[model samples]
Target chain A: MSLHTEYSGPHAQARSGPQVAAPPPRNSRHAAPGAARRFLSWLDLKAAPYLLVSPYFLLFAIFGLFPLGFTLWYSLFDYELTGEQEWVGLGNYSELLADDQFWKVVVNTLAMFVIATVPQLLLALMLANALNKRFRGQLFVRMGVLLPLVTSVVAVAVVFTHLYGRDWGMVNWLLGLFGIDPIDWKAERLPAWLAVSTMVDWRWTGYNAIIFLAGMQTIPRDLYEAAEIDGASKRRQFWQITIPMLRPTIIFVVLNSTIGGLTLFAEPMMFYGGRIQGGSDNQFQTVAMFIVEKAFSNFQYGYASAAAWLLFLMILIGSAINFMLIRRIGGRK
Target chain B: MTTLTVRRDTPGARRKRTHRGGAGSRIWDATPLTKVMLAFTIIVSAFPIYWMIVIASRTNSDAVDIPPPLLPGGNLGENIVRVLNDPDAQFLTGLTNSAIVAVSVTVSVVIISTMAGFAFSRLRFRGSRVLLLAVLLTMMVPIQQMGVVPLYRLMVELEWTGQLKAVILPYLLNAFGVFLMTQYTEQAVPGELVEAARVDGASTLRIWWNIVLPAVRPGMAVLGINTFMITWNDFMWPLIVLAGNPTVQVAIRNLNAQHSTDYVMIFTGTTLSVLPLIVVFLVFGRQIIGGLMEGAVKA
Candidate 1:
């Protein structure tokens, strides 16, 4: 039965039985050795690939996929971290939808996403375009721009939080040069969003630009040369040729920014001094922060799971919407 | 399309255009304006980090002084000592734990990624296509956020909370790393080379070690650096799981919360946390840049 199954296996041709073919009479004494060799080789061929790939699948199954499925299961029950679980089908989701604070967090998350991503991407695009031009110290400039990325997000938030200090921040000090009053960066909603967005953009803009620069490098030079020959201005060429050719890269970047922006947590959390409240009024509390607050702070494990699902859905909807919008860029003549 | 066809018609024309370096090169040439813009960009990119250092080195009074000091001060050593000795922050422990987690995660992710990459790219096996697609799908979902609840509960059940194991286990296998390595291996290792190695009766593992690993070292380096940077800077998960025992990011949070008024000490801790990565960046900046661009295009 084992032999039959082996014969019918996927690599049967390669692993065909040595016994099926009449062994040459001259080498009949070596049949056992030959079969052993074939078996070893068969095992090598059949097992090595799975062995090579098994670590990833095994680890991901335990850490990634299992938790993903369990999150959905957890969301269906009224679960708490204090070891209580009651089945309440969609109860958490329904309560979350009507929860005023939850909606505010969703709004804050989306507001910050748009506030951060739109200008961040636009600035990165322009930075990439500028960097695409041949320069003498190209590598130096690139490294300098990417320097912020090396700093931890918490570190960036710490520095920016101080810089946005209501009384004596350098930013407010700079504003005071123009006689403008001090702005309470954490107290107000819009200012808080701007402050957090700045932190996000400060860290990521250069990284995105480098990716965009990479994409720009892959576009054939002839297309630009042709557009130049046709008397199209540089600005027009960028809009017409560069944007169209960079569609795949744009899609990749936009989707990445969508997921990242919606998941804004550490910057705002640290901005408000490491409290998950985001502010006393919950002014800058992102959905991610809200989820953490619910699960860890309030011990609403099931409700936070539902919020996690909603954040996932928000990412999907945001990516799809942005993908559609990006596809239209340079689509028309 | 017309230009593409024209380039195909005269394949060397683009190369010739670049050599001519007249009007055609103008498009690629950096203008004075471009140089100025890039300079401003570099400064803006670097200033916050510079500001961190300036404040870290200054006195507490200098930290909030009107028109905040923009230059380094002599108090840096004193403040760093204060941070290291701070009982509440546990800054040194945070730094050491972060280093351990980052190195372990980077090494594991790179090795696992390279193996899976070689298998998916060089080996012909059933379910390869479907499995690779699954890895790609895995990359799309933010598993950390989605799985936080159950993962936390699992950790709690296992009694691993506040341990480095809780912080490090989830990150040991990264889908992005696998996807990157697979793309890289496909590009870097030729099919003919693998076939030739096989013809020499090289076992799959031998071929991987001798042929695939050597060829894909650059890809591994890229993945390793990126993974290290990410693991070092990872905030939310570590903050959630290891809140008591804390990584560097969480330690900074502790310092910020506990000593909100101790600007110099806080900045000192922040600077110390970032200093090692800056050193790594300085050493491997070129490879990091090249590998990132290369990975971007391939992926």
Candidate 2:
């Protein structure tokens, strides 16, 4: 703990500042001279901050940074759990491009991404607006909105699967009461997409609403008051004031929802009975689920790595486009 | 910032055209139609969870009935006991494993993020700004599936592939946690306090421990609960890492896989697994929501 013995380096305790080194205690007058020399090196200002902050960076290098680099490296090899990895050098990428299943999964992912994220953001905005009002039981309503988000994805999926069941499911039953024919939610493409998107919307709408609400709170109340004074309808004020002011928050919600939608795995996986292939027809298998299937189920690490890289690229591009879209929309104002 | 006032000031009147309430009044006041819409939305939001509990309370015969029970049945105790006693599910073990992982990860993240966030926010260290930027940049990069392949390999190399520590260790270095603490510390703890502590011959560690930690309790509470919820809900990573030793989510998956048709048992297991979180949310929902909203505002 002492600098005198631990760090005998030249610049260890040779600080020019008055408070750099604490003087020896006056009560320890009879104490040995060496005791005064032995300052607590743990208190060394130059080294202490680094020591305090090192854990996060160190862990990041191992778990985060290294894994990012290694994913790219691993994609080039024909790797397996037990077998020796061969130097494939873009072979995996070529195979992924040619794989029809991969393209099908990509199409499915994009469709589901749009289905889930679009309505989710729209609904979230509306819900945020509604909750931002001066209503009785506001806390109760807010908590109710967040209920889906609090529940585990596994639980949500399980419950939804029951609700979307062919015969006894509540959804079909409800449809029946409205004079509509019962549709098989899982087997059919459109029904399946709707069912899954419903799950996504149910879980996330409130969360995004909270974020939107936060953004809305920051907008000065005077803006709304002024708009009201001008005889603007509530709808007009919403379109003109609320939406424009919430641009940054909307962008955040959009980008995050894109990322979340693209990587959706659990809800679909559990809905389709815990299989990587989302359904018998593979109508809802996301790219993320496909990657897991390739790596774990099929034992094709190289192929999985390639798919993973593709997903990452897609997200990067998606985020860039989202950012530009928001910027353009903001500029139009 | 002005405190929000209830625009409707009429105590006894149900309907009033309050001209003095300002321009935002039309939007703020709830119409009969708005009430119906909001009520419907709230129902849609909370109905599934209510439905889950209903299913859990029903017997298998009651559960699979043509008109599935909309109300809670009398078989709650029986189903819970059956789910707990199921040979394949291992509900208790999975709960234990999840708790271990969640608690460990939460504790570690709070401590590490606090220290790192404090340093970045308060300490004047060399390359601090660059390091902080690096931390922020990591938040944007999605943890893709390929990264897991390499991460799994790293765990294998360290001979920690199947352990809870493997799951706990990587999550401890959350970029969001670091960013959350950094923002919280900047606003909550004054720079002059840190400077005062430094001038008093107190170590940086002491300042963080005795001063910064106590000051950021609310932030830490939010961070801790969020981390716990995430860790508890984590499925894919735990499934991959703890391959043989499945956590609660994986166990629930396996439960459904083996039983295949036992809806009552599956719902029971799901309910049991979800109960602890429901409890946590009920207790700390306000703090968690407030913290998240506050963080969003700062961002």
Candidate 3:
């Protein structure tokens, strides 16, 4: 990384600006006599680099940064759609702190994250191990795993909503074959959480498995051979070699999963039969869903902005912990 | 513990020992347990999609049957036609709207992200490091849900509330896209190539057009497909901005709401919505999988 940085310095200097390139040596063989050519050459050298990079910063400022800062500003007032704005001065945050619904939504989000991410990552590792082995039809199996990832989250929710149907759903029917009663997946809180997490897990496990598989491939094959010669079983090699070598990848997956899982919106919304609210009783409503509900449905812009800030703070804190965990793991070795 | 020291044990002989056994060893090495586990994974992976097909292929009555037609039924064509002709959902118009928005945003995202990525990777400028760090830091912030209120207000204030541009404009600049392109350009277009071009009096734009762009073609292709898919499948932002003018996802959601009791139409609409991506994935599975895993590993 440092080498690349140092390498780019001189290259950047060589073509830093068109003004420098416009002045030719007194007896240069190639010289542009026309003002147009010099101007074009100058634009190419000095202006193009900045022009190339300006779109992102420009759009990001207008759409990304402005809206975020506006949210912070909007949180300070009791603004609602089609209503007169009034200065509240941290009133929304105070109300949000005391609101039971806000706490419930936060807990619901955390529950879904824990429920979805734990098994998802574990199964991803196991699947990656299975995939890393050379075999017939390897490409076919690999593609099969990624099928869910490529499929849209809304589509997955649509299909799983059907599967989790009370009476005629495939899952319940399979359970019936084993003499278990049908489950009203969406009506009950635990069942709804499970159903939503199942959708999350199904979509992500394969994607993460591919990542883990990539990490596993980076492990030298000779290590497995050495372990084999020492009479270590495949399981032992996985425990002793694969897991430790995969620390960074594991950290990456966990942090990503934490973020993705916490901002749970689409699945819960769709799972609740296309309603924005999680259920009839708000059993499975996540913080994101609540924010949307408050902003659009209830038209409480200030309150929703406060909730959004809370969500951002949770993400910031969670990410910091994950970052520190990565550092600790890195420091240990 | 000795395994950690093994890298030094045979530094020069590493190449000789890489392929530990012959092809015969691979054929006889698999155990029953591993095979069963792999089979289970394959089934789990493919079954939901297969189930979607089955549900979409069946009629309303057949779909609600106790066994629920394990295999796809014979009503696929009829169901698809019904779904397209359904007046309430506007599937045909939604398809056109989705195509326009997705393609427009994808083209712009590819051009902008590639240009910015090339500049970041190859060009030296003041505050380049800080700018790169800013881009990466933005990735950690999930702003979609949080920013909806202000974004909605902005669109309304600009009289863009019901316009597709309301959805298209905000998403053209993606942090991941820039990061991916930068990483790819670094490896794909070597510094020596840029240095050589500079020595030959090639301007920055000239080098970018003649050298860097051609070198990163594969990366551009992957980024294009990824962007198109993300734009096409985007729901919440489009849901808020587009309002009554529906994209494909909004159309599918509308179908579900209007035909709440009719599983056939809902399933059919979803199947139609997912068909293009499925086809794209099938055709370019290798490149898509390779690109995604490459990005993940690099991250």
Candidate 4:
């Protein structure tokens, strides 16, 4: 708005003019210091705002903008850590498109995204509904649900990895009680996906629930009261009113989960005991792991850069799809 | 506001009101089933952490025992000692490094965000609106994933690959922190207060120091806590860059890799890594929860 220059420019001049004109004979001795003070204050008014905000911008330009641009540049070249640098010009992208392992990873990533997100969001919505009720120890309940979020992701992965251990693990042990054979969580595709999905959901569901609860709190109480007066049951009102009113929050949560879910790295990586391959068969390898594996393990810097860009595109597509889907939820009366 | 009054009403009065043709309004009062379901959710939320502790406290064979030890064992102290003394794990260094990095990043991010937030909210300047929008756009780009290759190259060129600075510098500027604080400052510090301070001849920095920061202290606390937690738990970047000298997360990965079958030792290290955060969560649980929900709505 340039409000700073407009206000400070003429205003400072006007104030200083009056001060100079009205200065007493005795005060004339202090005129120099007064003018210096005015100049310093003027500088503070004119420049402090920029100074205050520069750190984030400066740091972002260096660390954020540069790398983003550099990644694009790196993706265009056939650059490796130790090998000769050559121009690939989207060759990496084409190779990635045809690579069977790459497509498998993409499927694995999306499958895990759905496997993790569908139940996680639904559970969060229900949990939010439950927490929205007026209850004793509400704060206690919120803290308890959000406790998982406090633990490190690796720690969560490590614990779950042990629990899902094929032999003598708690999960398989529980399954044995159900007359089902012990599942190899790491060996098979479906079981591995399920294992990683549980880890994701366990860590994030409560956090999302809290966000949903916040959104629920903002919906007017009168809406519910009016629905109730119209003889609508609680369940009916929830379906008709709560779900529709929570559309924005649903979109927010859905987009966040999409980006987060597609970037599934630490959990699956730790699930396979820190192997970037995800498993021996690559059953649960994510695009993120693939990027890391290509760049660091194989030193294919340029190829990894292309894969990273594709991952970004995947997130964009994922978010757009989820956004449209969420928009459809309760949008049609 | 009406809801606040309704919530404050005596339970007996509320029950009486609900009884008199307000059966549907009883929705707000959780049924016993909801309570049971909520209890189960809490258990599900907390059990992994509890299980981690149990395994940490048990012997190696007891950890992978048939039923899997559900209760804490007497080996906790011994295991902790072993983990601390283990050369390969470097449990103590990881903790210290994580603490240093988390604190450094948290303090820097909070201060930077507050400064930027105050400016964006209070100080009217050229392009402020556009700059704020740019910050929002940056939040959508996952720079950590997108920038890994170049950032790694930069770190290697600068000889910062193994140092904590490489991990610290990139995360110092958090777009989310700036955005959160901007929203919070707008709501918390009134425009009239800034005008009044300006009329009183307070310098812009003074107004920020005397008025904005004090008003936004809660926002700062929220941001600080969240940043601390995220930084403490950050894995991918640290795993990539700080390979030999690692944070708690990468260290846990290393421990898992080294002792893939030594369940108790690995569990012990995991428990130790998460213990500090658990203590922080327990102490500041209320503020963290309140701040998070508040930030969620405002954001």
| Candidate 4 structure quality by residue, lDDT tens digits, A239-266 | 8999998887788788889878988899
lDDT of 4 by residue, B1-299 (tens): 23223332233343454344455556588889899989999999989999899889988889868877778988999999998898998888899999999999999999999999999988888889899989988888889988899999999999998899999999997999998888778767767667645655667988889878888999999999999999999999999999789898888899989989998999999999999999999999999998898777666
Q: B171-219, model 3: which lDDT tens digit per residue?
A: 8868878888887787677777687566556779778888888888878
What DockQ would you assign to candidate 1?
A: 0.47
Better of 1 and 2 by lDDT: 1
Error of 1 at A290 (Å): 0.9
Clashing pairs in 3: none
What's the CA RMSD for each of the models? 6.4, 7.2, 5.3, 5.8
Highest TM-score against the true fold, candidate: 1
Share of native interface contacts recovered by each model: 0.73, 0.59, 0.52, 0.74
TM-score of chain A of each: 0.89, 0.87, 0.86, 0.88
Estimate, for each residue in A115-162, the C-alpha lDDT of model 2 and write its tens digit.
888888888888888778777887777788787888899999998998
Model 1 CA deviation exceeding 4 Å by range? A1-32, A80-82, B1-23
lDDT of 2 at A125: 88
Candidate 2 runs further than 4 Å off = A1-43, A80-82, B1-27
Model 2 has a DockQ score of 0.38
The two-chain DockQ for each candidate, comma-separated, is 0.47, 0.38, 0.44, 0.47
- Chain B alone, candidate 1, TM-score of 0.93
Error of 3 at A256 (Å): 2.0
